[model samples]
Target: TVFGLVVKDYDGDGKKDIVLGGNFYQSKPEAGIYDASYGLLLKGDGKGGFTAVKPQVSGIVIKGAVRDIKEIKAGNNKLLIVAKNNDKTEVLSFK
Candidate 1:
């Protein structure tokens, strides 16, 4: 259950990358909670192919139930603002 998504060239390869945030706190009793996903980073190859990058490698781990993701420019830097439920907001920048 992806709650948030942002597409941009995070790796400076001229190809688009994807950041995914997903979590669900509510579900049926049989289904239990949907909180397994910490987040995911998908790097595109510009040929309709994508590779999943681990959070450790990407350094974009987002915990909790994500609600939204926004891109903002802070002076000379571009940043990602992640919003989640019952959790502190996360700000991210790629080096």
Candidate 2:
């Protein structure tokens, strides 16, 4: 089975305005070959819908898949996201 996911803002927003990624099953027969999906940036409309601002494609080559996302306050008008990429760790920030 193909493993994938979708993410969205819990608050009211027409745009998704969030990042989502996961593992996916291979369509063609390949041995020991794994493809990583890209991260997406969503935009919320504040109405109740979302649009994909960015498509899913890996920007960074990490060790593993991003299992979870945690948001933290980085600074005024800025936020940080701590994610677990397989056995490795990564940090993403936004302003």
Candidate 3:
């Protein structure tokens, strides 16, 4: 299930990027209730295309098993996300 979704310029590339947070695709009992292992950072190209980029592989980690997520503006006006994990919540800044 998707807890939240927002399209913004995540990479400052002047194109609309996508930020999605939810659990892995499944239809289990806790699908959207407890599964917190799905958050995606999709970069956008100058055109109208987007690419899913895993933060961990890129040296970043935004663990799932997350409960909720929201997009916000950091103090510097950059795109950021606040997510609720299993027992705690964390913030992730878009790069």
Candidate 4:
């Protein structure tokens, strides 16, 4: 249920990419009573659509999950991710 993803050009290719973190509901019996949260990297196709690039696990525990993501500006060719863990804070970087 998260939105408003921040987009930027981290690779200097003139195409804006987006970072997102969220969860996908899993069926109780099929998924063994657990949900999946993921941190995703998407590259803009320059035609109003995006393609998935990187998908990583967000948390380790059952309740731990990623709530939000923000891009930190640290000069060109670098991007910082301020990820909100279940009850803590984490920082991820893309360079």
Candidate 5:
């Protein structure tokens, strides 16, 4: 199941993109737990529409079922810090 989503300009092209987080590894959602899901990136065409795109951060596949997505700004950099339930967080930069 899809757990969280983020819409932002990932490519710095003035177009908003979509980053979805969720897990499908576990067929069923465990109670009080975040289900595992892969991340899917969608590129926006500046016209308020989007298309599925495989997101990569520094050529690494960024996928996980994050219970919370917190956007952190470190200087001019934009990053999505994904936090899981009782697990270590992952930092993914879509730059």
Candidate 6:
């Protein structure tokens, strides 16, 4: 249930990486809430392959349902912005 995602070279390795965020909170009582995902960071290998990186390592932790992901520029720096439901927007910058 990926509602938001962004792709970029976050590690400066000349390869594209991925950031995924999503969660399903609306469900019947019997079905329960679907919140297994805690966000995902996929590091690309430049050969069309990717490796999963943990949140602690990647520094991209998303909670609640993700709505959108966008890239923005702030003067000389570029940043990744994350929007979530009932949560504060997050910003990520890479060097």
Best by TM-score: 1
lDDT of 5 by residue, 1-95 (tens): 66667788877888987776765344446544444446677789998888776434423244555676767787788888877655678887754
Model 6 residue 7 lDDT? 90
Top candidate (lDDT): 1
lDDT of each: 0.88, 0.47, 0.63, 0.55, 0.68, 0.83
User: For model 2, how does the per-residue alpha-carbon lDDT over 1-95 read when each residue is reduced to its tens digit?
Assistant: 11323354433343445556554343356554354554555566766666655333323232345565655555643333435434555665454
Where model 1 places Cα greater than 4 Å from the true spot, the runs are: none
Q: Which lDDT tens digits does candidate 4 get at residues 1-95?
A: 34325678655578887766655344366556333444566778778898777444322122335566677757643545444544576555555
lDDT of 1 by residue, 28-52 (tens): 9898899888888899999888999
**lDDT rank, highest first?**
1, 6, 5, 3, 4, 2
TM-score (all chains, Cα) for each model: 0.91, 0.53, 0.62, 0.62, 0.71, 0.84
The CA root-mean-square deviation of candidate 3, after full C-alpha superposition on the true structure, stands at 4.1
Ten residues in a row with the worst lDDT in model 6?
73-82
Off by over 4 Å in 6: none
lDDT of 3 by residue, 1-95 (tens): 56666788867768887777665434566544445545677788868778888866433355565556666776776545556545467666654
TM-score of 4: 0.62
Better model by TM-score, 5 or 6?
Answer: 6
Model 2 misplaced regions, further than 4 Å:
1-16, 24-36, 55-63
RMSD of 1: 1.2
Which residues of candidate 4, in runs, are more than 4 Å off? Answer: 24-34, 56-63, 75-79
